[model samples]
Target: MTPVPTAPLVRWYRTSLAGHPDGLNFRRLWVGDTFSQFGTQVGLIVLPLLAVSVLGADEFEMGLLATFETLAFLVIGLPAGAWVDRMRKREVLVVADLVRGLALLTLPAAWLLETLTFPLVLVVAAVVGVATVFFDVAYQSYLPSLVPSERISEGNAKLQVSQSVAQIAGPGLGGVLVRALGAPLVVLLDALSYFASVLFLLRIRHREGPIRRSGRRLHSEIGEGLAFVFREPLLRRIVATTALGNLAGSVTNSMLVLYAIRDLGIGETGLGLALSVGAVGGLAGALLAEPLLKRVGEGRTIALALLPALPMYVLVPLAEGHPGQAAVTMIATSMAITGVGVVVYNVAQVSFRQRLCPRPLLGRMNASVRFVVWGTMPVGAFLGGVIGSRFGVLTALWVGVAGQALAVLPVLLSPLVRMRDLPRGLDQHA
Candidate 1:
C-alpha cells in the first residue's frame, strides 16, 4: 500500500477543545466508538446468557463460543492490517460496522424462527470477530490522523472514557433487558447500536486522500509489520506484556459467566450487577489515565498499573468459598481493580506506540501488536474450557490468576522501569 501523507500526524495545534477542527472529528470517532463498545458490552453479557441459560451449553461449548469470537484475530490479523492500510480508514470503519450489525441480526432471526443453535451462535461470533479485526486495526491507525501528536495521550484517554462508561452501564442494561425481553430479543439492541455507530461515522467530515496502490506482496507487507513490532525494544517489551496479560485474562473470562451462574449461584441479574459494579473502576481508571501519565510518566504508569490489580484476580477463585451475595461482591471488587489497572496501562502503552510509529506504518504496526496480544486469547479460552471441564471452573480461574500475576514481569524487568518519560516520536527513538 502507498503510504498516506504524514503532515496531519505531525500537525501542531494551540487547542483541541470541542469546537476546534481536530476536536470535532475526534468527537465523531469517539461517539461512534462509544456506541459500538456499549453494544459489545451488552453482547458480552447476553451472548453467554443465550448459550448457557437458553441453549444449555456446557463449559466446553462456552469456551468454544469465546474461542470463535476471537479466532479471527489469529487467523486474519496480519493480512487485515495490510488491507486496512491499503484502503480509506473511514470507509473501512463504516463497512466493518455494517457487517457486524447485519451479522448480529441473524441471531435474533434464528431465535424467532426457533432455529437458534450453538453452531449458529458460533458462526455469528466468528463473523463479528472478522469485522472487528479490520475495525480495530483501522481505528488505532486512524486516530493519529485526527489529533495532534503531542495530545495523542489525551485523545486516547478521552476514548477510553467512552469505553469505560459503556462498560459500566451496558451489562446492567443488558441484564434488565434480558429479563424483560428474552436473550434473543436483547441482541437486537446490539445490532441497532451498530447501526447507530454507522450514522455517527457518516457525519465525520475528515477525509483521507485516495490511497495510492502498491505492488507489494501481501506476505511481505505483513512481515514488515511483524518485524517493526518485534525489532523495537520498547515495542517488543510492550507486546510481550500485553500478549501475556490478554492470554491470562481470556482464560479467566472464558468460564466466568458459567461459574457465576452455576457454582456461585448468581442469577443473570446478579452476574450482570457484579460486572457492572466492577466496571466502575474502568471509569475511574480512564479518568485517572492522563493524570497518571503526567504525574508518574508513561513508563512508570505502564510498569506499575497492573501490579495491584492482577494480584487481585486471586480474589475471583476465592469467591467460590463465599455465599452468593458475598461471592458477587468479591468478584465485583476484583474486576473493579483489574479494570483500573488495565485502562491506565492501555492508555500509556497505546499512546506510546501511536507516537512512536511513522504514519505510513501505523496500520501495520498496530495490527502486528494486536496479532500477538489478541492472538493468544483463543488459545487461552480453549485451555480454560478444557481445564474447567476436567478439573473445575475454580481451578481454571486460579490458573488464569497465576498467569496474570506473571504477565507484568516482562515490563518490570525491562529498562522501562528506569525511565521517567518515553520518547515523544519515532524520530526521538531513531
Candidate 2:
C-alpha cells in the first residue's frame, strides 16, 4: 500500500496560527466564547443546585431535567439548522446567547420573589435548552467561515481547549460561588457572561453571507440537510460512531451524581475538584491534538483516541476506598479520557465535515448530525435510570463501559480506520 502523505508538524503549527489572516477577529471570537463559557459553567452548577435546594427535587427530577435539556437537540436541531442557514450565523449565536441569559436570569428572579417552583424550574431548563440548541448549531456552522479549511482541526482544537478550560475553572468556581452567594444568585454570573458574549459579537464587523434558501420550504430544506448527511460515506460513519458513543456516555452521566454522592460519599466540593482535575487532561489533549494528528493522520488519530478512553469509564466505579482517594482516581482517569477523547474526536470530525460540506449547507449539516448524535441522550438517561433502579449502580456502570467500548465497532468496521487524511475536494459519491 502507498503511504499516505501527512502535513509536517512545523507546517501544521504555522498553518494553525496564521491560517486565519483576520487574527484579531479570531481572537475576539475566542475570547467571547471563553467568557460566555465561564457563565455556562456557573449555570451548570447553579441549575442543579437550584433543583436540589430550592425546588427540593429528587433523582427522578434531575434525570428529567437532563432529559428535557438534551431533548431540545432532537426537537429543534434540524429546524434550527435550516433556520440558521437562512440567516447570519453570528447573529443567530448572539440572539441565542441573549435568550439563554434571559432564561437563566428568570430563575434567580423567581427565587428572589419567593415564587420559585419545580414546574417553573422545569420551564427554565426547557427554555434554556432550546436556546442552546440554536446557539450550538449556529456556532458550529460559523467556524468554517472564520478560518481556512486546512486549519479547521486546529481551530476546533483551540475552541475545545477554551471549553475545557472553562470546564476546569467554571465548575470549581461555581461550587464556591454557590456556597457563598447561594445557587439563585450564581445564575446572575452566567447571565453576565451572555452579555459579555453579546458585546464581543457586536464588535465583530465581518459580514457572513446568507444561505441560498431560494424557494425551498422549511420542511424540504430540513429534509435536504438530512439527506446530505446520510448520503455521505464519511459523514454516515461519523454520525454512527458519535451517536453510539454519546448514548453510552449519557447512561453514565445520568447516574454520575448519584454514584458520587452515595457510593463514593463525596460532597459537592469534592465532586467539583474531581471534575476540575479531569479538565487538565482535556487541556493537554487539545494542545497536543494537532501534533498527534499530523504524525498519525486524522483517521488513525481518531481511532486511537476513541478506543482507549473506554477503559477509563470503568475506573470511576472502581474507586472504593476513602472519598478523597476515590475522587482523585475518578478525576485522573476522567481527565485523561475526556481531554484527549473529546479534542481528538472533535478536531477530526469537525474538520472532516467542513471539508465535505458546502458553505450554504453547513448549518443544516451540523444540526442534522447533532440531532442524531444528541437525540440519544434522553433515551440513554431514561434507560440508565431504569437500570439503576433495577440492577443497581455497579451493574449500570458496567453497562456504560461496555456500551462505550462497543462504540469502537463502527470505526473498526468502516473505511475510516484504513484511511489517513480526509479525501481532498468533494467526491459526490463520498
Candidate 3:
C-alpha cells in the first residue's frame, strides 16, 4: 500500500471542530476535558508539594502515596469494567467526576479548618484514585460510540493535545497557586473543574446506545474479557509491551519531582517551569503522531519512538547543578517521546481491540487488559522509592532507564514490530 500523505496534525484538530454534526456537544466535551485536565495538573503538582513541604514526607511516604492511589486498579479494574458495561457509560463518567470533585473539596475544607493531616491527604488521594479509574475505563469505552472508526485517531489526537496543553500550563499555574493560596486551597480549584466537566457532559445531546450486559456471573464475565485479551495475538503482544513500558515509566515518574528538588537542587517553581517547558514537546509529539504512524506503519513507528527514550532517560539523572537548562532539555525531550509514543500506540491498540472484540465484550476486554497492564504501576512506584532510598536517586534513574530500554525487547521479538498491517480480525495472526 502506498503510504498515506502526511499532513499537519493541527488540520486534524480543525476538522474535529468543524466536521461533526454534534459539533457543539463535542466542543463542550473537549472544553470540559481541558478544564478537568488543568485542575488535575494542579493536584498533581500541589499534592506532592504538600507531602514534601507541609508533612515533611520522605521518599517512602511519597512512594506510599503513589502506591495507594494506583492499588485500586489491581483490585477493582475487572469488576469496574463488568459494572460499567451494564450501565450508561456517560452516567458513570458524570458520577465519577462528581465523586472526585467532592473528594477533592474535602482537602480544602479540612485545610481551612486547620484539621488537614497526612492521613486526610492519603484518604482523599485514595478516593480520587478510585474515581479516576472508573472515569478512565468508561471514557475509553464511550469514545468509539461517539465518533466513527476512521476518525477515532483524530478525535483522540484532539484530546491528547488538550491534555498536553494542560500539562504545559497547569504545573506552572499550580506552582503559583500553591505559592499564593497554599496546597490545600489549590485542590479546590480542581474540584471546581470537575463540576464544570459534569455540566458540560450534561449538555451533550448525543444519546448513547443501551449498555450490553452478560447474564453470566461477574467473575465469569470478567474471565471472558481476560480470555479474549490473552487469546488474541495482537492484544497479547501489546499488553506485554505496555506492561513492561508502564513498569519503567512508573518508576521514573514516582521519583522525578523528588529527584528534582534534592538531587538537581531545584525549587518548586523552577521544577514546575521545567516540566511546563517539556510539555511543549509533548504537544508537538501528540500533534505529529498520526502522520508518523501513517508513514512508518504502527509497529515500526512505535519501535522508533521507544528508542528515543534511552538517551533521554540517561540525561535525567545527570541533570544536576544546572537545574534550569538541564531540566528544560530533559523534560522537553522526555515528554516529546512519551506524547508521540502514547498517541500512536493507543490509536493502533484501541482500534485493533475495537475492531476485533465483539461489541458486547468491549467493556470487559478493556477492564481485563487494564488490570494486567496497569496493575504493575503501584508495584513499580513502591520499588522505585525503595531503590532510590537505598541506591541514591541517580542510581535509581539508571535502573529506570535500563528497564524502559529493555521493555522494547518484547515488541522487537513479537510480530508487532515486523507486521506491515494491523490484523483484520482477532483470529488473524499478526
Off by over 4 Å in 3: 1-18, 22-24, 321-325, 425-430
lDDT of 2: 0.77
Kindly indicate the candidate among 1 and 2 with the higher TM-score.
1
* TM-score of model 2 (CA atoms): 0.91
| Per-candidate TM-score against the hidden true structure | 0.95, 0.91, 0.91
* Per-model tally of clashing residue pairs: 0, 2, 0
- Best TM-score among the predictions, by candidate number: 1
Top lDDT model: 1
Q: What is the lDDT of every predicted structure here? A: 0.89, 0.77, 0.76
Tens-place lDDT per residue, model 3, 34-85, is: 7778877777888888877777777777777777777778879899888888
Score candidate 1 by TM-score against the native: 0.95
lDDT of 1 at 251: 90
Tens digits of per-residue lDDT for model 1, 359-393: 88889888898899999999999999999999988
All models, RMSD in angstroms = 6.8, 5.6, 4.7
- lDDT (Cα, 0-100) at 92 in candidate 1: 93
- Per-residue lDDT, model 3, residue 411, is 67
**Collision pairs in model 1:** none
